[model samples]
Target: MKNYQRYTKMFSMPPVRSMDWAEKTCVEKAPVWCSVDLRDGNQALIEPMSLGQKVEFFKLLLKIGFKEIEVGFPAASETEYEFLRTLIENDLIPDDVTVQVLTQAREHIIRKTFEAIKGAKNAIVHVYNSTSVAQREQVFKKSREEILKIAVDGAKLLKKLADEAGENYRFEYSPESFTGTEPEYALEVCNAVLDVWQPTKDRKAIINIPATVENAMPHVFAQQVEYISKNLKFRGNVVLSLHPHNDRGCGVAASEMGLLAGADRVEGTLFGNGERTGNADIVTVAMNLFSQGVDPELDFSFMPEICEKYREFTQMEISPRQPYAGALVFAAFSGSHQDAIAKGMQWRRDKKCEFWTVPYLPIDPADVGREYQTDVIRINSQSGKGGVGFILQENFGVNLPPKFKEAMGYAAKDVSDKTHKELKPDEVYRVFLERFVENRPLFDVSECHFKQLAGGIEATVTVAEQGKKSVVQAVGNGRLDAVSNALKKHFGAAYTLTTYEQHSLGEQSTSKALSFVGVEGDGKTGWGAGIDEDIIQSSFEALCAALNNLFVSRGKD
Candidate 1:
């Protein structure tokens, strides 16, 4: 029976073809960073992280590199207000990093939010109010004229408070849900706020136009931002920002499109952790820049650590497949993907990349923190010769003969069909070892005698090599060592163990340990792998397979 089209789908990842977003978006250095962990992100979290969790999450974000962090709305709660005051009283505020406090246009909360950041070295009072037609009718119950007054009066009050503080205070304001708001009305409210704030060229007013619910496609988001940036007043002293959520899972794409349109800053959480579907994945967005040969301006490689810290603070699980920061983003699972990755890595080793062209990889894992080279192997009905070939190439440094690759693949299929499942690690290893190394039937009941004698364990291992030679043995630290030493005597020291590494071959403690070791003899290096419940026996046989590689390499030489 022919297999279904499973492996056919992985060949079309976006990184394989795109290359222009980086050059256009990140050219301006030192862009403003507005973090939404408190307001936008926290609101989306399922549990709405506790006060302690919120404070810890904020501290980690501030520590990572964000200069402007939106600490929660003090007017919303006594608890939140106390948290903001705690930041100021503890003097955690730095000279370069501005403490940002958010509030609505309502006078009481707005003033209270300002009071929360009163004694900071540098600060930003980010006041926001809903301006979309739906929000105005449903939430604020205000018309365009009424919303304009709310925005203008709030900006004037914020400007006055910053002036009174006599410190380096910056002002930023967003017309909430601006993506759906009429362009003319949104621009009017934004320009009025900019006029009231009277920002200088040195400290441009940040105009954040949020696709609050992410109702628009990426192109539409870009168009909306472009429209506003062109129409907004104080173009010289204006920073266009976008805070698009991932209600539709296109947060990263939308953010990229917005940046291309005219956004100077994009606010998002690390793994797009936020309300609903989460915010735009800043991780993907930033790494896209790195992949395109442009500096992303921010050092986001602290990704895993940062995400782990996020997990600790928010008590949330970071999905294993999250982009750039996920556990498995850099890992390959299919045979074709693994082969491509292996070749790409080899090409990159030369270190003189003309433009970072490699298959199945947009950014190197090393640039982040992933270091393990793995292509998750599986025994599905659709898997091909490439899978076994990769194991030979990657685990043993052996490129199988064309006939060997196809024959082994059929062997795997036969075993899989019999077992009604994919071949387990031990099963896979045994097939190859018997053919080329141990020279014995993997399941043959060979007699093994072990005795703690002399300086170490003495082992005599005897078996019938399925089609080639009789079982031999070797000796070492323990039973396996003795068996290996005994085998070497007869095998003429074909290969010796340079290093032995054992890890769970798959997701089972009951699963056999898979062993890989380096071998050197006759002036060359080769690797071999074996899997078995008996770890020592597995290593012994695997080393024998590696040694046999000497014969193949010698012929090639």
Candidate 2:
């Protein structure tokens, strides 16, 4: 907090205002997605992926429905060059997919790049040069004219080589540090390259503007993009692409705004894997569209599978809070969040609604291969009754009575707090069982026979306690009441049967009935549960369990 003068803004705004992009509320369509995982993502890893690993990742990109993938800078390394050759020779590149390779504006690298894609059916020979003011003054020691010629010369050479090789290879060029370059100068250099390539309608060229190092707010970048989109020559015959990094944590924001600025394509990696803070996450951008009712054209329906493969190939761990693909993205551990989510899910089911309007969840977990029972309502010390009850009903078909859910929630929360860990669904069930269900400590009913009477039903109840047995008879308004009266009379126990409820466990011919009972005594209450094939027997067992809990609560057991 004391080092106030240590930091300063590193980026500058464009000289002109391009506020048209700001009027758009959201991206109305999915952009052409290009996965740079094999190149940009792999190069940033501490241990770059092996040749086989790169191949595996290339296949994954195809599976995810990426039509254009930046395979690698083949001319940069033997592994990269051979990886392209391997894909070409093995026929791994699909006919519909076009592979893109990166290269500097230098000649030998460009020549070797052509060699690397010698037999490719379709490829984009991407070339780039730094055009920023710092690169001109500090790194390249060249004038603005010199940098502009570098891009022009490279563009001319790529077209000539593609012509000689008799291959219809498309071309792409990037002003490497577009964000740092003057917007007017950047447009001039891009137009110079466009003049050389003479891109046509069928063979459209790509002019990728990369935020090589993010420097300013996202709106500034959007202004820069709109400038290029509006003023560039051959705009209709060009694919304006964006490649933003996350130095300032605004890659996704910049990319979205860039699309609104009339850019046609995006280049990013899964989970934002790239140099430094990483590239714009294609997964996040695509899922953002999917949540808005636009089909992203990417198959994230098996996100868990894709995540697993990504981890195995990259040797990188996906953050637990990564949007849409993380383990805990859909999980609600807060009491209030769980309660709202539980009520929302029940509302949907009750109304048989077709739309996804669940509280706290932007989209249904099931839509992305996540289970609500396991992934949505996680139990912890902060969990509440609705979540606890939802876990029971969804997982094991054991629906707790609404009044009893509070007690069940307290039992689960206490166990989780004492253990200092979250309770799984099965653990929650076990806590419920140990604390409330079949709790017969004071006495166990060996048998119970109900007889019809003029005033009410009479019950002959046999009780077993401490290896001793006794039989007693009583009358009440109902069979459960008669049993409760008989037990209280035999043990001199004084309690009021306050709550009773039952439901069938399943819809089978011999479905078991589950009963819940609550007894109030000594200014406190006790709860119990019982399940049996016969409803009357289940109610009798429920009464016995309640009596035992009452005795335990009174310190009389």
Candidate 3:
């Protein structure tokens, strides 16, 4: 935090105010996405992916709906050269997908790059040179005229090579580190290159402006993009692109702003894997648009599978909190959050809502290949009654009464707290079964029979306790009340039947009926559940279970 005077902003704004981009609230459509995973993402790895791995990654990019993918700098090494040759020789490149290869703005490299893409149906020979004040003064030590000549010579060679090779190839030029260059100078260099290419409506040129090192706020980058977009020659025939790096952790923001500034395409890596901090995360950016009702054109429905494969290929661990794609992105572990999410989900289902407006979740997890039971309402010590109840009803078809859910939640939380782990859905169900459902330690009801009376029901109950059984009879207003009275009389018990509810567990005539019962005694409450084919029998059993729990709470078990 000390000696901050050593650092100054590396980004320079275009002289004109270009807040017009700010007028646009959101990106209206998907940009032409180019995956640089094979080139930019691969080079930054501690061990770059092998030829086989690169092939798999390339196929993945194709599957993800990318039409333009930067394969690699084929002229840089034998591996790179062989990879391109393999794709070309094996006819791996699809007819619709255009494979791009990067080259430095040098003649020999340009010549070798053309050889790599020689008989391709479609390709983009991307050429770039560093054009920043620091890069020129420190790395290149070349004047602006010399830097401009490098780009111009490269453009001329590409044009000459395309003529000699007799291949219809698209051209792409990048003013690498364009953010640190003066906007006017960068434009000057790009327009000069465009002049050599002489792009037209039929064969357009691409001018990619890369934030090689982010050194200013995102607004500055947007302003620079707007300036280039407005002043570039052959503007209607050019595809303006943005390649933002995340040195300032603003790559996605900068890319969004750049799109709003009239850039047509985006060049980034999945999960933002690239040099330094990384490229703008194309997944996050695309999903952001997808959430906003724009089709990102990329299929991420199998996000978990994508995450698994990405880890396998790149050997990079995605943080659990990574936006949209991480393991715990949709997980609601806090008690209040879980409660709100549970109610919101119920409200959606009750209202038959067509849009996803769940509380605390920007997008539905199910929309991205995640389940509601496990992915959304995860159970931990910090979990709440609503989440616990949601897990039961959604996963196991056991819907507890609202009051019983609180008790069940407490029991599950205690287990999780002591064990220092999260409780899964089945584990929560098991806790419910052991604590409330069919729970009888002091006594068990072997059978029950209800008989109609004048204005009430008479119940005959057979009770078993410590290997002994007894039959008792009593009368009440309802069958369950009659059974409760019979049991209390036989055991000398004293408790009020405060609540009872019942419902069918499944949608069939023979489906089991689930019953919940609650008893209050000595300022303490006890809850229980029962499931049986007959509602009457289930309620009788529930009454017995509730009595047993009441006995336990009174320290009689």
Candidate 4:
């Protein structure tokens, strides 16, 4: 903290007031998404992807609905050059998708870039040079005129080469460190480049504004973008694009704000994989628009598949906390969050809601190939009754009674707390069976008989306790009540039947009946569940199990 005085802000603001982008609440539509994963993202990796891996990634970008893809700096290396040639020679480039290649604003590099994209169905030759004040004074040691002319020459050569090849190949130029440059000067250079291309309606040139190294807040970048969008030449024909880095961890925010500032395109990598903190995450930005009900025009419905392939191709790990595409983004481990989510899901089902307004979830997990049982309601030590009950109902057909779910919740949390691991749904179900349904440590019911009577139903119940059997008779209004009375008489126990519920496990005629019972004794309640083909048998077994729990609570065998 003491060294903080060593640094100062390096960004420059636009001269004019360009705060109009601040008035927008959200991005109204999806921008033209261009994935730089093969270029920017791959170069940042510890081990750059091989040619085959790059090819696979390119195919993936096309499948994900990207219209423009910045393949790589084709003039920089043989591999990059060969990758573009591979796409063009093998007819891998789709008819609708345009492959864009990067180059320095030098004659030989510009010529090599043009050769790299030869015979492609559609392509954009992108050129850029450092235009920041620091680059001007230190890195390039060039005046503003020299830098602007470099961009202009690159633009002129791209036009001449395209004309000679009889290809209407589009042109794109970037003031590479746009964020660190004076906004007005950056605009002047972009206009100079645009003048050479003379972009038309059919061949609209892209003027990319890259953060290069993010140095300011997102609002500052948005204002700068607005200045360029307002003053750039051939505004009607030019596509204003934003390429933001994540130095301040505001790449996605800057991209969104840039779109609000009238930029039409975004260049980013999937999951924000790129240099330093990474490029703006196209997935996060697109899904942000999707969550706001705007169609992002990209297919991320199979997000898991995309994440897997990204890891395999690039050897970069996707963080478990990454937005929308992460493993635990939809997971709710907090007890309160789990409870609210459970209630919200039930409310949706009961009301047949047409829109998603679930608590704690900005979007439906199912919308992106995630399941509610496995992905949404994850059971850990912090889980509660609602989450436990939700897991039972959603994964299995076992819906615990409202009061009994609380007891089951404690049993599950105890196991998870002791094991120090999250419990899967089936493990939770096993906990339910071990503690409630199949539990009979104190006693078990061997047999039961019932006879109809005028006042109530008479029941003859046979009970087994520690390998001993006993028979008792009692009468009550219902079969379960009669059995409860019989058990209390035989065991000399004191308790009240506080809860009873039942439902068929399935719709078939031969389906089993499941019953739950609760007994209150000494100001505490013990719960149990039973399943059998016969309703009467299941109810009796449930009563017996509940009594056994009550006996155990009183320290009786």
Candidate 3 per-residue lDDT, tens place, 1-557, comes to: 77898888777778788789999999999999999999999999998998999999888888888999999999999999999999999999999999999999998999999989987899999999999999999999999999999999999999999998888799999999898999999999999999999999999999999999988888899999999999999999999999999999999999999999999999999999999899999999999999999999999988998888888889988999999999999999988898899899999989999999999999989888998988999999999898998899999788788898898889899989999999999999898888887688898988887789898999888889899998999999988888888977987878898989998988889899999999998887888888889888888778777878888989875
Task: State the lDDT of candidate 4 residue by residue for 199-236, as single tens digits.
Answer: 89988999999999999999999999998999998999
Candidate 2, residues 1-557: lDDT per residue as tens digits?
Answer: 97978967655565677879999998999999999999999999999999889898898889889999999999899999899999999999999999999999999999999999999998999999999988999999999999999999999999999999998899999998888888999999999999999999999999999999999899989999998999989999999999999999999999999999999999999999999999999999999999988889898888899999999998999998999999999999988899899899989989999888999999888878999888999999999999999999988788888878998999899999999999999999998877787677778999999899999999999999999999999999998989999988998878898999999988898899999999999987888888899998888777777778778878895
Candidate 3: count of backbone clashes, pairs at least 3 residues apart or interchain: 0
- Name the better of 2 and 3 by lDDT: 3
Candidate 3's error at 255, in angstroms?
0.5
RMSD of each: 11.6, 1.5, 1.4, 1.1
On residues 5-59, what C-alpha lDDT tens digit does candidate 1 reach at each position? 5423111112122323434744344345677777767776667777777777777
**544 Cα displacement, candidate 1 (Å):** 10
Off by over 4 Å in 3: none
Model 4 stretches astray by more than 4 angstroms:
none
Off by over 4 Å in 1: 1-31, 349-355, 375-435, 442-557
Clashes of each: 18, 0, 0, 0
Q: Cα RMSD (Å) between model 1 and the true structure?
A: 11.6
Ranking by lDDT: 3, 2, 4, 1
Once fitted onto the true fold, the runs of candidate 2 whose alpha carbons sit more than 4 angstroms away are 1-8
